[model samples]
Target chain A: MHSIDFIVLFGTLLAIALYGTWKTRKSHDLKGYLLGDNSMKWGTIGLSVMATQASAITFLSTPGQAYQDGMGFVQFYFGMPIAMIILSAVVVPLYFKLKVYTAYEFLEQRFDLKSRALAAFLFLVSRGLAAGITIYAPAIILTAILNWDINITILIIGVLVIIYTVSGGTKAVAETQKQQMVVIMAGMFVAFVVLLVKLPDHIGFKESLVVAGKMGKMNVIDWKFDPTNRYNIWSGLTAALFLFLAYFGTDQSQVQRYLSGKSIKEIRLGLLFNGVFKIPMQFSILLIGVLVFIFYQFTMPPIFFNKTETDKLATSKYEQQYNELSKQHQQVFDQKRVLLGELVAADKAGDEESTTQLTERVNKLQEQQESIKAEAVGLMQDINPDLDSKDSDYVFITFVMKYLPHGIIGLLMAVIFSAAMSSTSSELNALGSTTVIDFYKRMVNDSATDAHYLFMSRLFTVFWGILALLFAVFATQLDNLIQAVNILGSVFYGPILGIFIVAFGVKYVKANAVFVATVISEGIIVWLYFLSRAGKLGITYLWFNPIGALLVVAIAVVLQAVWPKKTT
Target chain B: MLKNDSFMDFLKTPEYTEAPVLGNWKAFYLTSIIFFVVELLLFSYLTIAY
Candidate 1:
């Protein structure tokens, strides 16, 4: 990035963090530190809930996804509103009824202390690593674009979030999140309009969608019953429902957002507000990606988006071969754009056979582009033999740096950093709260006063922030932040949601049945995960949430009936 | 001045409600239908028209 861009981006983030710390410096007790003193309105709660969930991955990788795939990935959230409704009517009230600090706290009241500890342990492990990935998301980029050390970037961003979060606690997180959401939305909107303006005049927005549509990027809904299809209606509805429940219901990051509300009704209103807005927000972001894909159609893009490897090739003997390949790659872009124009004209003229032929030819040219990219990656590996070649994560950033103008580019860059901070800050804040209220204060030192717990909460926040920084330094080893968060959620969200479903929905299921069933269910789910990854099972990873939840609930119910206990 | 209150009474336990379970279900369904209509309209414009 140029000097001006860097100034605007980092300056905005630092200013917001400083503002948050100043705004809520008086949170001197446990309730204020952990739960924001139960004084937030539905608007702050609503925006915080959305901001907490909207990670840097949502900004960076999702548009890249839309550029490649269209708008269908949004089906994954079809279950969210249903899940939200269930939470608003059921889960929110139960959490409020128990007057708990963390969602896992209720598991002990309704079941046993072991259940609470188990749930909290699951949350810490899942959210802690996720916090690391969130930190990694934008840090990886700042290091890449700024040509700085990746570890330095990670530490810089990590400390920025930790300082305010540790000092001001939950109020700091919510207040900063509110401002961050405003910047995030405004930046993204400007980026979207800028991307649109950068497109060619003749190939307007409608024509661009037609080209994307012809490429089969607009498949928004798939009613097919295939378990392997990741974003189809069935996987999205049932499996996504359980995943949402586990995430928004049992997960502390989300649960704590609403748990800070002053009343159950406000909590419901806040959650339901999110339910209504989230899917469309995601769809809009993905739509921006799809538009970016079309923007690259007329324009020539990098053969390999991962500049780190591309830089390595610049010094190697293979640089000559990479240059030759780039010439061919440019030719492929010329051919693809020519074919897309013909395809648009053919469809406009109502020529069925010509349209089909144009689509086929266009797809073949697209494949040629992919093959050239594959060749570039292969050449890069030959240049350094140990380089990571999967560059899907770098696609969007490469586009922005190459195509966008200066000021807007900086704002979009700020959007991504904001997303990373929002998600990472929430994760650190949640991890600290859980560790203090659910574990340290609850188990080790139950007699501590509010001020003492508040201190511990801030202490743990700083500790987790450092840990997440370490995680970010190693994040480049992973493919992308978006995939990282989903993969992490798929691992633990299922079994945790299963226990809660039994607790709330099936009241008679014995604790022993649940405890035993969770272990067995998790084992089987792991087996299924391996099978699917090995291509042995046909089920997609999205289906794992429902499958795991159903397995535990079904088995526990059967087990509870078999070993009936006397009424309490 | 900041006024903070612990919301102990906000928990709507099943027994705390005056309405019957079936009535609550009806209210839920009604709320859901309203949500569906609003969402359907919102996305239809946000997608096709935008």
Candidate 2:
């Protein structure tokens, strides 16, 4: 980050944020603060909804994922469009007719207050912890690449979010998201163009893709049936379905996005818009990662992308041992590069057998690289027990710092900040709304005046913001922020989605069935997840969503029929 | 697609609308079938393709 670009980047971000605060300054009442007085149209609501879900993790780890894995991860979102359609058809109209401020509000009317509080508490606990991971995701990288102090970056991001949110409330969050989404999209386009220009001049896009294809990075459509395989077509469609259904239907952060819409129709349109574009947008980001993989083919990439580990290796007593691994890694890299060149030539010259041999050699080189990285990590662990060794999260940022020009570097930095703020602000905004409307006002004092609720909303916003910042400070144990949230959501979302699906779809089953079924489903899901992690079960995290939801629906129906209870 | 008026008949008929009595048996059955088919097809594709 040089002076000029840093100035432009900071100036632009601060201006947009300040402008949002100013624009929403007149939001004096509780409805104004929480729901923007229902003045926003579907377009703004749609963008805000997308921005909230497409957090800093979406920008950071996703591309890094694409760079390492290719566009196949996009398949995981294949179920999203269908889920969105279902939400629009069912959940939207239910909430609109009920005129509920929070999704949990309906649980009280439909079931009881205890059930409502249970759902709300679960949301607060999960969203609260997840917020920190989202904030820390981009901050860790910026700290590493620029050698900027991580704590300072974390504080700056936290304080900026707190300031604008404290001033303008949800109105500012929505307004700023509209602008942040634009900037994020534009900055990514710039990143993609810059990478294309950096590729070999004569190869063109097709050969670059062919290069990516020759590598295993082009595996887009894996129709694998293995439950443990996270990104195959099955896990993606099923697990992603549950995840999306729970997220858009039950989770307050997303529920509140549609809640702010003027009518059910507007809400439906907003959600439909997100559903249509979500998959394509993810595909594009993953494609950028695949391109980065191709970009490194012609360039020298570090033996390990995470500098924290390699730095430990440098100072270790086994520096000699580390040096040997480095040599082997470099030798393999060169060997692979030569073979890749030969593979491309052979492909062009129509030599099938030579192509086969070259493919084997390239795989051998990548395997050697992995072994070298693992050995180096082991040495670093021996040298200093406290050293961080994860490299998957650091790959894309390492590429950006080593290759991209200075001006665009600052823009990409802003993109990270934008993603963090957009997502965090949404979380804080939704948390405050749920607290005031669902808990404090509804359960504690349902007759509280609009002004009091509004004041409490701002109060909770500041409270949760501080809580998220505190969580971000201690979230160092998470290897990748993106994966951590999904893990949390997979456990919680399945049962939550099941509760809603049963509420709408299962007419005979009352809330006891769902409540009991949810408890059972959640227990089983957690047990299964732990078992899978321990290598006993083969279930993937994605499948947790559908499995838990279905389990609740199935169990709840049977339980209710066997042990009948009066309807609410 | 089910016609709006025809679909509306199941849920919004005057008798059911005036007094809540769970009148959408056909809609319930149809929706159940649809979800079953979708989930089954998705799983079947995975099993066969894998």
Q: List the DockQ of the predictions in order.
A: 0.11, 0.06
TM-score of chain B of each: 0.45, 0.49
- Candidate 1: where are CA atoms >4 Å away? A351-353, A384-389, A474-488, A566-568, B1-15, B18-50
Predicted structure with the largest lDDT when compared to the true one:
1
DockQ: which candidate is best? 1
Tens-place lDDT per residue, model 1, B1-50, is 10111111222434335323235455654666587667656544444532
Off by over 4 Å in 2: A386-389, A477-487, A565-568, B1-50
Model 1 steric clash pairs: none
Q: Provide the global lDDT of candidate 1 against the true structure.
A: 0.80
List clashing residue pairs in candidate 2.
A67-A289
Expressed as tens digits, the lDDT of each residue in A1-568 for candidate 1 is 7777888788888889999999998999888888899888888898999999998878877887777677878888888888888888767766775668898887776667777888899789878887887777667765676678888767766888899899888888889999999999998788788888988877887888778877777766666888777877677778888888888998898888888998776777788778877887887888888888888888888887777778878778887888898899999899888888888898879898999999999988988998988988888887677666766567778877877888767777788878888878888888999999889977899997878888889889988898888767766665566464656567677888899988777767767888888889888888888787789999887777887888889998888888877322
